[model samples]
Target: MNTTRGADGKRTGRDETAEERADRMWVELIQEVRVAQTGVQILFGFLLTVVFTPAFARLAHTDRVIYIVTVVLGAAATGALIGPVSLHRLVSGRRVKPQAVSLASRLTFVGLVLLLATMTSSLLLVLRVATQADYVLLLVAVVVLWYLLCWFGWPLWVRHRHTSEQ
Candidate 1:
C-alpha cells in the first residue's frame, strides 16, 4: 500500500477527503469528550456541594480559597469539555465541520488541562482539611507529577517513538 505523509507528519492510511476525515475525527473526538465530560460533571457537582456542608464552615481561610479555586477550575473544565457538543450542534450542515473539529479538538485539550488543575486543587484542599501533616505539599506534588506522566508523558512518548517519517 502506498502512503503519503501529511504536513502534520501523520501517514495517510485511508483514502478520505477533508470532509470525510473531519466527520470521522468529529465522531472520535465526541466519544473521547464523553468520558472526560462525565468525570468533570460528577466532580463539579460534588464540588458544588462542598460549600453547603457543615464541615465547610470550619475550614481555614486558605483552604476555603483552595476550595473556591477548585470549584472554578471544575466549572471551566466542564464548559470546555462540553464545548464540542454545542459547537457541533451550532455548526452542523454549515460546511465548516473541518474547522469545527479542529476547534473542538483544541477545546478538549484545554478541558483536560483544566480538569487536571481541578483535580490537583481538589486534592490539595481535601488533604489540607483532613490532615495537618507537614508532608501534604510534597505528597501533592508527587501525585501531580504522576498525573502528568500518566496523562501526557506516556502518550507523547508513544507518539514520538512510533511515528514514522514517511
Candidate 2:
C-alpha cells in the first residue's frame, strides 16, 4: 500500500522505475509497430504491383499522380515504422533507453500518420477507378474522418480526460 510521486510531483500510478517503465513501453511500442508495419507493408507491396498492371496505364494523369503520392507515403510509413528496430540496435547498451523509447514513440506516431495518408489516398484511387462516381470524394472524406477519430482523436481525448482527473 505504498505510492510514490514522479519527479514532476505527479503520481505515475505505477510501481516501476523510469528504466523499467521505458523497457515496458519499448516492448509495447514494438508490438504496436509490428501490427502497423505489417498492414503498411502489405499495402505497399500491393501498391508496388499496381503500376505493372494494364489498368494502371489507363488511369488518368491525376490518378497517376495520386498513386505516386500514395506510394511515397507508404514508403515513408514503412521507414518510420521500422525505424525503432534499427534505433534500438544502434543504441543498445548505451544506457539511454529512456531517450531511445521517446524517439521511437515519435517515429511510430509519424509512421501512423503517414499510414493514414497512404490509406486515404489508396482508398480514393481504388474507389475512383472502381465506381467512377462523384460520390467517391465524399466517401473517402468520411473514411478519413473515421481514421482521424479512431487513430488520434479518441486517444488524445482519453489521455486528456484521465490525466486531468488524476
Candidate 3:
C-alpha cells in the first residue's frame, strides 16, 4: 500500500478512496453524536415534564417564558442531533456518503449551538427562581463564557494552531 504525507507533517497510514474516507468520517461523526444525543435527549425529556410539576405553576411569568424557550431549544437540539441517523438511513445505498457526511456534520454543529442556548436559558431560569441575587445574570454570563471557551473557543484555537503548523 502506498501512503502520502500531508503538508501538515501527518502521514497517511493508508491510502483511502473518497468512499473509504467518507465511511471512516461517518463512523467517527456518529460516535461524537452519540455522546451529545444522550445528553440532549435526557435534558429535553426532563424539560417536557417540568410543566406538569407542581412547582411549574408557581413560577413567575418571566420564568415560565424562559422555560418555554429552553424547552423549544432542547427540542430543536434533539432533532438536529438525531438528524444524522435519519439522513444516513435514508441515503445509505444512494452512493452519497460524502455529501451525507457533510450535511450531518452541519446538523451536529447546529445541534451543539442549540444545546448551548438551551443550557444557558435553563440555568438562567433556575437561578432566577432559586435566589433573588442580582448577580444571577453575571453568573449566567460567566458560565456562557466558560461554555463558549470550552466548546468553541478552545477547539477553534487548537484548529488554528495546528493548521498554522503545517
Which residues of candidate 3, in runs, are more than 4 Å off?
1-14, 164-166
User: Compared with the true structure, what per-residue lDDT tens digits does model 1 show for residues 1-166?
Assistant: 3344466868677767777778889999999999999999999999999899999999989998999999999999999999999999999999999899999999999999999999999989888878878989998999999999999999999999997665
Model 1 residue 13 CA deviation (Å) reads: 2.0
* Candidate 2: tens digits of C-alpha lDDT, residues 1-166: 3344566788778777777888988999999999999999999999999999999999999999999999999999999999999999999999999899999999999999999999999999999999999899999999999999999999999988878533
Best by lDDT: 2
Worst 10 residues of 3 by lDDT: 1-10
In model 1, where do residues sit more than 4 Å from their true spots?
1-5, 8-11
**In angstroms, how far off is 114's CA in candidate 3?**
0.3
Per-model C-alpha RMSD: 2.1, 1.9, 2.8
Candidate 1 residue-pair clash tally: 0
> Which model, 1 or 3, shows the larger lDDT?
3
Kindly report which residue pairs in candidate 3 clash with one another.
none
C-alpha RMSD of candidate 1: 2.1
lDDT of each: 0.91, 0.94, 0.92
